[model samples]
Target chain A: YREFYQCDVDVIGSKSQVNELELVQIVDKVFGLLDVNVLVKINNRKVLTGFAEICGFPDKVVDITVAIDKLDKIGLESVEEEMREKGLTDGAIAVIEQILKLSGSTSEKLASMRSLMNGGSASGLVSETGLKGLDELEELFGLIDAAGVKCPVEIDLSLARGLNYYTGAIFEVKAVDFQIGSICGGGRYDNLTGIFGLPDMSGVGISFGADRIYDVLKGLDKFPKSLASSTTLLFACMGAEELRYVLPVAAALRSEGVSVEVYPEPSKLKKQFDYAEKKSIPFLSINGGNEAEAGTIQLKNLTTGEQKSFSKADISGMKAFMNM
Target chain B: YREFYQCDVDVIGSKSQVNELELVQIVDKVFGLLDVNVLVKINNRKVLTGFAEICGFPDKVVDITVAIDKLDKIGLESVEEEMREKGLTDGAIAVIEQILKLSGSTSEKLASMRSLMNGGSASGLVSETGLKGLDELEELFGLIDAAGVKCPVEIDLSLARGLNYYTGAIFEVKAVDFQIGSICGGGRYDNLTGIFGLPDMSGVGISFGADRIYDVLKGLDKFPKSLASSTTLLFACMGAEELRYVLPVAAALRSEGVSVEVYPEPSKLKKQFDYAEKKSIPFLSINGGNEAEAGTIQLKNLTTGEQKSFSKADISGMKAFMNM
Candidate 1:
């Protein structure tokens, strides 16, 4: 089973263009640091509603939009059949298809959409919401372009998020190099808290699918080397007497912000050293039964196999020697 | 309906004096920064086992430990009855009472225990595991004393953490000023991951109850003004088109590391201004219908009630004015 971890940032009582742009900026900063190229496509459910109105299926907007949104996966033919089953007419289906196919540069796309949907006829008036949506979409793009964001911001007309709450700009972020689906997504919801009796408030936020990002980074070999950073020293002891001699020395070094570990129990020297070797621990402090009586300790550099004995009385010298 | 958050740090795969003392130093740093006086009580489960074995309820270690651990909630008589039900003898009960009464400096207490348990055929060599535990506890305190950690550690013989996994040093941290229970607790478990088929490995860890800390700070009014830091500026808009003009400017300032919020929608000026006031938002950027065409914006400092108009071309000037 695959696990998912949610990394969400939310703003309460906000549903403005500035909020939308700031969210985009945050997304850019985080993923840019992760060195992942992305495509951020946006849509407005209101525009889909206008498309529904022009198709004479105003009341079935949810059904029509839901089916059309699955066109990428289930195919256009299957969506059309689903629409037919939902009581949408041939005109409605054609309008939906035309809107889904709408594409061009920011301004060109808006111009093409306006001309196709606005015929100066009654049905054209029915698509008034669609025309207004184009105006809002233009404003969103103008903000993105002026902000000089490097990532592409496409006007994906068929990108209808299935949630019924989104009222304005809706967003989905897709990784450019990975075959996975959208790794980050969110949008504006005008009256979510209204269900909790806090009406008319709007919010916009985004959630990063942390588990997916972890997988993608692992697959790309992008995780930083410091992820596995651990203790620099492992104190080795063969029995109870040795453990007593090294205890104070280990404690003194640890107080100075050093990462240190002590092997518990009086195990065999080889077994303990092998355990330290497997963890890639670089230094070993060994206090044998003889050393305990002598009040001395030995430091071994695991990497170079160097060993040196030090007087336990000169704790300061040991600190300097260990570079703690 | 209270809320809480946990902050967890673990020492996995080792249980050395160095690992244990380093954990103490980290805990000291955390609590020192938060500036709260705490009492850290230290104990060992192996000692608890010896106490149980000497109490003639060796097979009922779990039940006996669980009962006595609740001594703070229930009285001593209740614990005695629970021990008796587990088939404890009068000699065992007397030893249990003596253990309960044990206290002093770490070394002094251990020496007293040694004399009581080991001298003159008192309790059959004091159980080898119990003697081993005393040695471990002595080393632990030697490390603490050598480090000069500021927090006080109490050697509580009755402090048995009831978890099934812990094998060595158990710890509990409590704030001296608060009336709540231990806000942090953990211990060494020698074979936790072993249950997942990785045996003989040991780990030590502690978890800080962030929610409880938050409550404690809230009770003491210790959270500084900077804790709830939010954006300094809120761009207020008159209509959808006007919001388009201010979005990019907000984005640019935010990119420069200034926290910013865009007022959602172009509602009435009064409503937007009041919303800003409620959130204690400091500055208001008003780029309404007229300002949009002129390519200028109004900046209002809510704190000083000072308002000024500036050209959009003077974005650097606006940033300077807002102290970005």
Candidate 2:
């Protein structure tokens, strides 16, 4: 099996707008450069918690949420069965089923939730957290709308990311064309630091699933050619002296932003050509005894088998030709 | 623990100067953009294989290699025991041990290996493939010399990446200041596609250990400041009608690349101010009936508690202020 690596950028110690904006902006810039279109969906746990409280399911909050979060994966029936198995009252399960089934524009869904909760002993149990959650949603959407970022920002209440530490906005980005699970996801966990004995600190961050993205990009053949290049030229030498003589010329080209490499051994020209062909190297520099003595180099195009001789002191045109 | 992502890019089919050069170039660009200095090391397995064959223990090649590969992790004693356990003769083990201890520049090490391997049953057994490896190494170094790339690239035989697929060049990059493991590493594997029924197709690749790099960057506080932004401004409203008036203006500023958010409720000004403070929003827009009708906004700087009035059309300046 192959293993990949990850790099997580996070903001901890505050749940302020600056922290959230900062994280999202970085996400935007990094992925933006990679030319991936992403839909960033955000939600808050307090909203879900409030929905639970208002549904007369205060005690079964975790159980109800944990099951409902799997709505997309296991479907509604399994979630309801899970709720029933978790000892939720029939009324509570019924309400949860209704909530889980609730879908519409985000505002419409919230409106429906509000109407459902506007009843019984659970009235107003959606309480401050849920109400604040609703307000936060409105504000967040307002911010997103106001930002006019090209990437779609959706308010997804059902996006109950499985983690227990999320307190405020939870974010996940999905590529429009790929579906190997989320390409990037993260959230604001207000109490993660509490585990380390530092309470009440909040943090938000995202992890880009690099391996999966790589697979996705590779499968789609989306890697930019520029990202895969090593060198633009290779020097095929016939001897150590030739290699030594041509080193400075290659060095000068390299200093001028051309990537140059010289073959170390004085091997057969065909063998050197084989090496160049296999690595996808585009250009080959041939500087045998004659070329060395004349202070000239023959640049051969590995791809097209084209060759041109260049004076040692002036190879700018050759550099451009090699780049192509 | 936080997780980042990693991707390994490999190219197989040819072990030439082009392939090795491409490897180094890709390494330079990616790591260069990331502002990470890496030590790219190259090694040839053919040399090691030559040592194994000339040691009179050709059958124990894999065992010898596997043991020696663990030298950095478990030390020489463990490798010796591993060879002993694999039934290598004492004489062969001594020969292998002597070759393993070869030190100095790469050519010097190669010289020593050749000296030890000469006059044995395996004499001249290290022919074309082995010689080709040395030639490849020289070509690789020649290319690197020619390129004059700023990143440090070295040749070390001890870096036997634990795999048999490598037919030509192998590479590993280690970050100097980080306490973590190899930040990046990969090599040319000639037979990777052989498992997929495409033998002899050589491929070279490198993988960046993004997660470890992220940890190191985070630990070093190397993240740029702009990455942590959330909303640029919070539009505090006097009432529902006031919010309606602010929406279009918010949208306009958003269109101009400013992240603007509006309060959902007509909360007290103090409460709104506290919210702005909590969110770390630097600017707040307060639209009273007068300002709303006048098509102007009263902008309050939360950090300095400074207020300024701007006409609706003048909001594009927010983008410049934030990005600049």
Candidate 3:
């Protein structure tokens, strides 16, 4: 199926052996770091199959499902027209439309579907496969509750992911505040590996569209400011001799987990200071002939205009001065 | 030109305006961090052109250079055959072969080439364009020495990069210990952006092939072991209730810069331990019903088999324990 995010499966097994509850938990844990509100909408292909069978158009399942999948993009009128062109009777089209309009809290929707399946006029309409799909979704929701997933999990019957291979729960994640398509999507597929001569294997997966997520974060100004500067301190030298003296000190600071750089080529002091300023380097250390002989460095705080000399041995003090 | 690494130029200006000295300094500084021995080999297209002119076939410059570029891959006999096919006479081909065989220290090679250009009745045969190329190389070497670049710089006459666009210095970096092709390569292009409506823009750059460097580092076992694990601590809870209790604690640890994850779903203790072991998570914090009620967690060091109980206020202590 086409999706914005690249998909990767967590577990692969037969359709009946796919662990729906564990999948929900895994998704919940995976998305736990997001500060913004998110919704995980789930649906099942079997539900669509049962609905088509009950509507007396089981042979036209793929066509009906394909039309319904484009509902959001093409609207109800176009979907109905497409289904009609596929030879679906108006009555079967009406039944599919009613199911698409089903909505409520996850449990409330499940309850509504159950009543529709068992009510006198509608009784025996939903196939056993449809009931099994509803049961699987109910178990998934129950486990999600038990696991205390922070994100909302909704049973969106209208979310018919456009893929004929999906056999069980399909998941689509969307940001609550962002007006965009799904940031993540995936579903369970049966016998995917069977095409490669490994039979009966099923799999389920979800993937986050990293580029879209980055765009969203950028639009929201959520990126931390400190990420811009890789160098915490820059050593400004007066000449090649000073550079030679400062190289080892810079290397030692790097070894102590401090990101440091030595100004190559003894340029003008103003140019070196400008370089430090543009790079957002807070601390600038100068080891001229005097400092080099004394085994000390003159450290300047670009933000504060404060300067001090620290002995070469006091790396921790220098680190504290730089607030690294 | 196609290259293994993605090339990016630091300085761009007209051919005559671009400062070649600054380019050498920039390259020297950029590669200063590499601990392994590296050689920066330099050549010039103008020198190749001048050599072709002095050999009495200026119009065959491209053809002769193309043939010689394959010298390392196809050997001297094949290069001669290709040059012959390109219509270079035996005498001119002999001269080009002699130049290709010229080898020594960088300065010694320059001395030999200078004498070749002015020594015999063939003296003054080398054009001023070729002499200018020699002069640029001499200036680049002078600056490299003055800048005290740690890497060895070499001038090889046979180092003819196949690209016809290079107007000045061409560089290729080779790791001394590695058997792969050049890890980095680039050259000065006279009017690279001119084709895009920006005329006379000369640019010089070199690019490090990150994938090749990574492969070399991997083969040498130079990658740090700590890169394998992202999580420093994992909390293994007994049930959903304990999981809820551990979630906030894990978040707090994460806020303090300790990579932490809570075992989702409160799986079996053995399974949780196995996950921590496989992921190389050094610390496992357990907060079951009793520990949850006591507002403390029993943190175990998976590697050292040390266990200790810490209260909620002891996050700083746990940070120390994790060495994060």
Question: For each candidate, what is the lDDT?
Answer: 0.76, 0.71, 0.72
Top-scoring candidate (TM-score):
1
- DockQ versus reference, model 2: 0.10
Which is superior by TM-score, 2 or 3?
A: 3
Q: Which stretches of candidate 3 lie over 4 Å from their true place?
A: A1-38, A46-104, A107-135, A142-151, A175-183, A207-324, B1-35, B47-127, B138-150, B163-165, B191-201, B207-211, B227-320
Tell me the lDDT of model 2 at A254: 65
Please write out the lDDT profile of model 2 over residues A51-126, one tens digit for every residue.
6787666666678778877888899888888888988776776667766677788678667766665542223344
| lDDT digits (tens) for residues B69-160 of candidate 2 | 78888988788888889998777777767766767875676556555555433234443445556667776777666655678887765676
What is the C-alpha DockQ of each candidate? 0.28, 0.10, 0.06
Ranked by DockQ, the better of candidates 1 and 3 is 1
**In candidate 3, what are the lDDT values of residues B235-263, reduced to their tens digit?**
88587567666666675676667887666
TM-score ranking from best to worst? 1, 3, 2
**TM-scores for every candidate against the unseen true structure:** 0.70, 0.54, 0.60
* Best first by DockQ, ranked: 1, 2, 3
Q: Per-residue alpha-carbon lDDT of model 3 for A24-140, expressed as tens digits?
A: 545565556545567888888777777777777887778877887788889989999999999988887777777777777778878777655543113246577777777877766
